[model samples]
Target chain A: MLDINKVKQRIESLKKLPAIGSKSVKEVLEENGFSRRDFLKWSGALAVSLGLPATFAPVVADAAEVSNRLPVVWLHLAECTGCSESLIRTDAPTIDDLIFNYISLEYHDTIMAAAGWQAEENFEEALKKFKGRYVLCVEGGVPTKDGGDFLTIGPDAETGLSKLKRTAKDAAAIIAVGTCSSFGGIQAAYPNPTGAKGIHKVLNKQVINVPGCPPSAKNIVGTIVYVILFGQLPAVDNFNRPKFAYGMRIHDLCERRGHFDAGEFVEEFGSEEAMNGFCLYKKGCKGPYTFNNCSRERFNQHTSWPVQAGHGCIGCSEPDFWDSMAPYEEPLANHKFESISADATADKVGITILTLAGVAVAAHAAISAIKPPKE
Target chain B: MKITKKIITKIEGEATLKLYKKDSLIEFAEIEFWQYRGMEEYLKNRNYMDACVINPRICGICGHSHLIATSKAIENALNIKITKKAKILREITLGLEIIQNHIKWFYITLYPSVKEINYFKALEFSREIAKIIALIAGQFPHNSYAVPGGVTCDLTNLEIIKVKNFLSKMFDKYQEIIDINGKSEDLEILFEDIPKETGKGINKFLVLGDNLYFKSNGNAEFIKEEDSISLNKNVLYKGSFYEVGPLARNLENYLIKKVYEKYQDSIYTRIFARLYEVNLIFQYLLKRIDEIDINEKNYIKPTKKSGKGVGIVEAPRGSLIHQIEIEDEKIKSYNIIVPTQFNLSNGTKESPSPAQASLIGEYEKQSDLIFKCFDICAVCVSH
Candidate 1:
């Protein structure tokens, strides 16, 4: 449903007037001791990550070269700045993250110089000048209660809700950068005091939801790069998430699948089974039901993800994961899934969901076979 | 009187400083954080282990601090006595997180306010340090790898060697940039414009929680919260203002002592204290990383899962406290008092908060510098 022509038109109309001493991605890479070959290799890897063919590496490289012409306005809302922090710390120093440096970042409070009236004026001017030519990246959720005064901005104390709406009005592409913006995150759980909700819930338009507590920087940066590369929105799922990244469940690709299928499980935190890197099914991994690329792409520069670090996948990338994925250390069998019950095993759930790996031995990995609840 | 309202950006979220100037000096400054997410309120009735995951969402930059605090609180509540190896891993991750945060604070947050130096180099190094974290704690900013019993990570010798390599590379970069040594000329270059003698908040300092690098088992019992004009809860020690951060932690260090004695509790001391603390922590972690016995158990199963407990941790900003009371296997109450609340309490004109007091006698631009000197987190303060 992404209109490629509209994105192309916006790219063509990027004639606004803000001079940010931008550098070309190639120049930046070379300046930072990376060679031209490194740039091409990184571009190729990025193309692979974006699910584009190896032949599209040149197209991706072309996107990086002209990425500086794009204006980005990153907004912080009723959530932590993890997504923004994650963006800045996105350091394989790869082609994926280099897109950030080259993009004309018009208004991001984290790295932008201006504050108060200068900041407010710069924000106002960019929206006016760039109009429909800027990419808007929002990091948190919107609080709709108390007429949206819970979060305010600048010297005039403008409401954060209004700032988001105003910026989103003319954005060439709107990206809900984190889970907070995409699915209301933790603040919308149980007794939601601030009445916090996802950006899409309040806005009239659709946004590309890149959901994660602090999503893998590669995924976050890759989404942005996808926009600049093809000049169109990436193919998305039912949740408006890019299919390349969020298409498969984390369980499908989890390295611990053999352990789960073999009926070996970590009974407790420091148990022998845990040290051996056994399946964390008994320890309550949400990886099976959780849809994400954390198992594949990993985090912090392809180093290690949650499961590799020895904890169960917390399912941070799923919608309303905070509420739905509660009693965190317990299995999801207790939840109100139609096919699942308290005594159900991964094998049963795997069978019910045709796509999930048939966990033939999940019944053997259950509570009775494993360590029972200790008082 | 000339009143000027300015929104302080580029820190962990933003703050509005309403300054009232009499002649040239600021007479009284009011700091307001309009952002509020009811962190403690939503935490109510959540499952006990759930708090360890949810509490860290309070602030992205210092989530490790919250994770440590929340994890420790659950440990204290449920009588979960983790192995020493587990403690070491937890402390290692926490230390690296501080280094990562300080790297950003120095380059991304504090540096640009002073100069236009390209800080991406520091960010690159910080990721090396963060990779070390991901190696241990899964991820940075919001990794809930630290559970109550212990951390989830079981380190390999390869990971240990990788951590050492990262630390070596990190220090190699650190040597190039930060050197607050009394003999070092870097301080003059970094804080060239600002009057180094300026910033003197409530001179008193405080530190809470058991620490890894520094020695502090300060109590959170004396802490109290009162209503303030700012959206942040006004935190006080026995109902009075006190400073709580790096300057509080390291007053006696050779690198910071000379400067501290020269400009007691000023921005120079505060900034140097943080910078020097980075130097000290990096050295400490280098040695501490060697002490990890991977053969030892990472955790111990708790006997009880219900009780009242408090967890205090010295986050990058300052002391972070998480108090929890679990009843019938659920969180009956959860309270979080972040470091920013201690630093920036918009108290009455006669008696402002520690960092607020620092802004009282400065010009507009310098006040922004001084306020950032405290390194307050608007997100944490409201949470």
Candidate 2:
């Protein structure tokens, strides 16, 4: 229950923050040949996703109109730049919503025109200019092993871990964008040769984790919008993720739940059963166990998600999903690759094994196929 | 001349260019990639199907390319037989990926670098194309809908209608972009004051992937990765460096023919080749989408699960190869030879990589624009 008065009061003061360069958000969008209507419609959709009433569109519109855009320093570490691609690919690029109108992005490695020493200067200058003001948005995990030489940054070649430390030391808020930065991601899975860890683990500050192999633009934007609107991190789950976006289980809101209840399942990919859009539980759909709004918000401008396209969810939004969520073809709890029977036992999915008979098999059948299950 | 090191940003991942200048002339260049996620290394000990999900993360812009490539690799490893309908559908989606990738590269990367203004509207339309992709495959950038057999999603005639409607709106948006940006086709519009015939790197081509328009040279049929394949960033085909991407597609477009006649294999020929390919693919897709018989099957599972095979695709950047050695459905070793490696391998006076050879004889400062022409993908090469 947020107080409307305090929200209004906070917005009034936050609106006075200094703008980047001479260009207002409106001017930048227009100069870029973008219509304000598209941005407005997008932000309004973001409000709806934020659980604010559809009527609250004007409230957001009012705040965004006057709110001085904060500088966002986006960093890439041991990553695929998928998160950057995910964030910058869309017009608005929300984590589905506000890289455009709400923030002044001073330095993003992928989108910025400059490179080499000039690019490195841009990063350093942004840190100096917006010291303690800009939000440090990291997109990958930090490698802290063997003196962290596995991943280095800039011409000076400082370890990625140190670069992050230097950058995060003076940030207003720190947001780890994707699963790599959120939970050490794929690199952290299986042997973890680079010794990568989530930014929250590496950093001393209270880092907000937005875990998804590549989280939807809406969820990414939704978290940033929460910070912009409330001037603080929204309520977080146990994983330090903003609850506004990660509160519900994908199973509860899944479009194919009825099939799961009816005991109908997709036995194989592209089968008549699959074409019928039966539940993917037997086919290893992680929807029943995973959390996030993929089914509702979708991806690439809310067009579709993995399950909707007839593939099983990989439980990507959860922590260490690369390790835990695999044997991606089978259910999370029970690695019964041999059966689609009625009395199948769930495997070792730790946090939320949606329908797999509830038990934590932290490191279960993920490493097994012809071999026996792990202890 | 002192060696000038330029850190090339604004790629799928970060990269650096080491320019060896002699008397103010760029004599040779070496591009370096710093991070390696060990993409192939991690895929080991995992199930054969997992590579589809993991490989796409290698590069967000070309995730679908990786997905299709990985699916094909696994299918090859397992000797899967897919229907004709699946092949067409894969082509359609892959074409969509190349189209959206070109638009983003043109608008987001190329436009901003050259014009110094952000044309943000068309990016929305590009996402609309990604929506079309998501309609068929579930997600863009990362969705493992393409399995060992065929694809996961089965489309109906009604869904095809939705895709068409979206395409119509996309056409209108592109019209808006061309209207605002004035469809500048000249090389100056892209490189901004850079002279003609500047980035004419080694005038050779390589297209390993089989596409309908581009005739494959039968290079891939006889060679296998296991017998002899470089395990590093640099790759060689029959002991020579070759360029890939649209430039290598060798499209027989009138404009491309004229451009090549004028500038040879310079940046103009290379860049125009991509734009021309996008136009060709877009037209082909419009016709092909209407021809999709919803009655046809989309997938067929493989018979065998233990073997070695390679999957190759002409990604937005260039030729992408996925090599696999699977034992009993579990990956024994996975090797991915991405395109940038071919274009950006170490170069010398006698023999040079495509992009590297392009840099020779150019001035030091012109290296950035010239390098961007290749669309270097750092993560893909490293992965």
Candidate 3:
């Protein structure tokens, strides 16, 4: 039987905590013990049921709570606050609250109560206090031309380029939080004007990059926690992202790999194949080249990710997805059969394949028509 | 002074924020959009049908929606009248994309701050949802399903049955979820519970209602139906134009509009509007699927003719307009007005932009209010 009064009592008691208001207390109670203990088991069971990473449960939980929480000094470059909005939405056990309370987030632009010169002062103070100790988290990319004139700092007086470098110098480790911060993002695509560059390029340091239009909140949190626990950053790949997070390509984990192998694809957005969850390769998905934990971390607390929601990977996690991943009608990497040389245009390959398929079908039909009667 | 910020990138391009302080309270806030793709420029000199594949890749989360919208715009420019079969097919795909987008937005963007699950389950849920999405769209983030003329694939009975089954199962789960967590109806009670969104101060509706008298095929509400309001012009609230997006879409709908009108334009309205879309689209998906005609071809292969065309579709975000001017088989001029342009642009002092209206006049603290109002996408706006 479900305990009612006990839950109410727990709510009443938990509400006594300093920050645990009655609203929060009620939420916890409403979820019952599942929010406390069963959430992981439930997720683990579901992951196993869904043939995903089952062991990631405790790993994620334990990563959420580790010792020596690193101080993170977040630097904003040229961009919107969507990345921050996405971040605050991560649902790890009190992770948002924990991020606020437990971890030493010395300076952040979006949610920080301080603004203007006072905000800059706060950043300076934090940098001074946590020099050679804090983790530097960079959102957005650095504009290189005109002395980074594309954006300005707290006041428009000085450029943001100097401000970013000044702060980055004192950091123990650096994390590029978005695709822009990771590999120049859309800003650096095609006709790059501002001459944008990722964090590692501007700083010339081995910064861990978490690339996405806006990366998963859980991925961000897990990475921070991993850093806190292990002291040095987690093992990163060539892109300087934690191997644990960006180790696998999206294709490896894509649910529609079966469809790709079966030669089934969604030719249009509203087709029946799309409703049936077919491969989006033919429709211009970047799953084959993109690398990230989106297939695992997912946006909005695993409710759904991009592909699951009926869109393909635009290779946001890759370098210059906007420029390199363009002409969405074609794939970025190898085309199967190596049939058409990599240099061949999508239209040419498509036409050639169509012709071959037509000829093959015609020959098969003629042979069938001419075949002797079977017993 | 104490300062706090969540450094996040990868959601919708790159976003970093810095807050300034006067004493203990925040005084000024700066939001930076570092990445610019120049999509308008990218579209230049490309085939008009390029949007069918390219627009969807703009933002992984809403790519399919963009693709459909772009395709619709092309259909309009080309004067290609779609049959009911094509309309239903379009609706089904768009509806599914909308459903998944909203659900994922809730799970990934909104739910994290709800003080519900810890970080562990959040990751787990994200993975599961991504897989489920992949089962349908082939990949996550940016799926390119919208093709010019019509959808790329035809629906088989088996595929339709599978989709119907999945949708039914998902809806049942969501119903239980609302019942447990609290339904939008509970939120609707904000008329009495939350005073800010309702009462006399409620804003007027600015929508794309077709009030025309004649029967036009591509019209949203009723082709050429009277009483349909023209939403082409900017929305004037008080003395200025208010932008549209998921929130604006909700205002146009009859049901959630009531709840949101009650909330006026608070964070509740912004959040609820998107969630309600998720719920509404689920129903729309079923209806669209039922109306689909399997026998008729969904697409007509377009010849790469030398001409210009514009495409527009109602993305999950809002009205996405793509204009393409082609010359001698190459794109000459390409212009796109994304939903974010309306939501995030800086407006004049009088009426202010929709995001600006939400911010300039109201709210004691500006950062939170700005985030609520702007609903910004640095990528979409900048690029």
| Top of the candidates by lDDT | 1
Q: Best candidate per TM-score, number?
A: 1
Q: Rank the candidates by DockQ, best first.
A: 1, 2, 3
Tell me the TM-score of chain B in each candidate.
0.96, 0.91, 0.74
DockQ of each: 0.54, 0.50, 0.11
Is 1 or 2 the stronger prediction by DockQ? 1
lDDT of 3 by residue, A29-91 (tens): 234333546545533433332223544455434333332234577877755443554565453
- Alpha carbon lDDT at A335, candidate 3: 36
What is the alpha-carbon lDDT for the whole of candidate 2?
0.74
Per-model TM-score (chain A alone): 0.84, 0.86, 0.72
What TM-scores do the predictions have? 0.92, 0.91, 0.62
Docking class of 1: medium
Q: For model 1, state the Cα shift of residue A32 in Å.
A: 2.9
Better-scoring candidate (lDDT), 2 or 3: 2
Fraction of native Cα contacts reproduced by each candidate? 0.80, 0.69, 0.13
Question: What CA RMSD would candidate 3 show?
Answer: 11.7
**Per-residue C-alpha lDDT of model 2 across residues A118-214, encoded as one tens digit per residue:** 7889788988887887877899889878878778667776888999999999998999999999999888876577888899987889999888878
Instruction: Write model 1 residue lDDT over B1-383, tens digit each, in one string.
Output: 99987778887888888889998799898888888889888777667888888888888888889999998888888877888778888878898888888777877777777777677666777777888888888877678788888878788888888888888778666866665343335567876677788978888888886667675735678889888886777888987888888888877677687788888888888988887788788888888878888788777777786799988888999888888999877789988888888898877778778887888887777877788888878888868
